[model samples]
Target: MLKTLQTIVVAGALLFAGQCFAVDMTGKVVEVLDGDTLTFESNDGRLFRVRLKEVDAPEPGQTFGRQATQFVETLLKGKSVRVKISSVDRYDRAIAVLILPDGRVLNRELVSHGLAWHYRVHFPVDPALRALEYQAWKQNAGLWVDPSVVPPWEFRREKGARKPPPADPSAMDYNGIFDYGLIGNPDTKLFLWPDCQGYPEDSRGFAVFGSELHAQKSGFKQSPGCSRPES
Candidate 1:
């Protein structure tokens, strides 16, 4: 069953990849939702929420987020452009490549200006995009000016931190004092204390750490939703 599931996943990925290159359309920008998303209307007046392919921009609340959106608006608002449709994102936006009148690639432009990151986790890394990001990083352009710039993905995760069910009282352990081992989710790279409300009852796929420091050393960060106990 595990092998079958893997096969299904691979097939689905290939199907989506093929769909990405299967369509092209021309549209006028109707709205600028954020740095990475826009609403465009085709010649026939059908609207599509378009997300720039392979570029992850900062969320509105992040540093340079507003500047990135303004930049896009300056270049695209009320303008017509050609779109190479990729696939529909989970939010129902059309993932696409935008070609400006001057022949600039909008996705590349955002990265070149330090307004976005290459969406390497979701899409294969493009050498050009990586080079642009590095150049921007070196120059301290846009959001790069911030010393501790958090990736939009990480920002979103921390902002939307989940509140898991309270840890069961029966699960407590001690050595004269209450001892609550750290619970780490390797997938999310987040760890929670046993006393945290988000701590899990089931330990099936999680790793138990001897301490918060141990979890940190193992590349796990404390869950933002979980508060630390006084030391």
Candidate 2:
């Protein structure tokens, strides 16, 4: 009797630990709401709004948004995934890392495919995510395929229009009109064409501008790379 009681106690403790870290469970992904959101059914028959951890994909109106959603749709195909439950968000969604049968981490794969951002705030636990993002930037994968890019977070803040890809990243003719972002301050704006050698890196604190007029309006005076004397 005592041995049975001990086994029960140990099992309960293991369950608690799994809850604190992450509960490993298999679930059929019934819906791919977006690139980063999904609905799944647990084996035991519980439904959950599963938010993919550590990646933020573009919103509906943002550039490549639909493509990102479609990317996940094509990947999942209403199939089952091994969900490692992380934490629950305020909306009661079971945030998790969904894994494919082939051993792909869905969250990492999204970022690797340039379909999402690493969401560094929620994911400092893994620097590999940051590396994946950087690699995507370098490879010009997905949205980064366009040099003048705005992160989804910045897009939400500015509510700006999405611009088309640069005609040519390697060309020096900026034409004073660009569909991407340029950053500068009151003194001088540092506008690098998407193909410019020193365009968007992971560095923070610089503001992104969609147009030359917008940059000028914001007091970002174009000295060199951004403008030419209107000849």
Highest lDDT against the true fold, candidate = 1
| Candidate 2 whole-model C-alpha lDDT, 0 to 1 | 0.69
Off by over 4 Å in 2: 1-21, 123-125, 161-231
* Root-mean-square deviation of Cα positions for candidate 2 versus the true structure, in angstroms: 12.0
Highest-scoring model, TM-score: 1
Kindly list the per-residue Cα lDDT of model 1 for residues 54-115, writing each as its tens digit.
88899998888899999999999667898888677665567789999889999999999999
The estimated TM-scores of all candidates read 0.63, 0.61
lDDT of each: 0.72, 0.69
Question: Model 2, residue 53: what's the lDDT?
Answer: 88
Let me know the TM-score candidate 1 reaches against the reference structure.
0.63
Tens digits of per-residue lDDT for model 2, 1-231: 465335434433544446655678896887778889977777876566778887889887878899989988888886777989777765656678999988999899889999997764421247788788878877889887777666676678769655565577744223333233456542345544343455456636676665576666776665454442221
- Clash list (residue pairs), candidate 2: 169-195
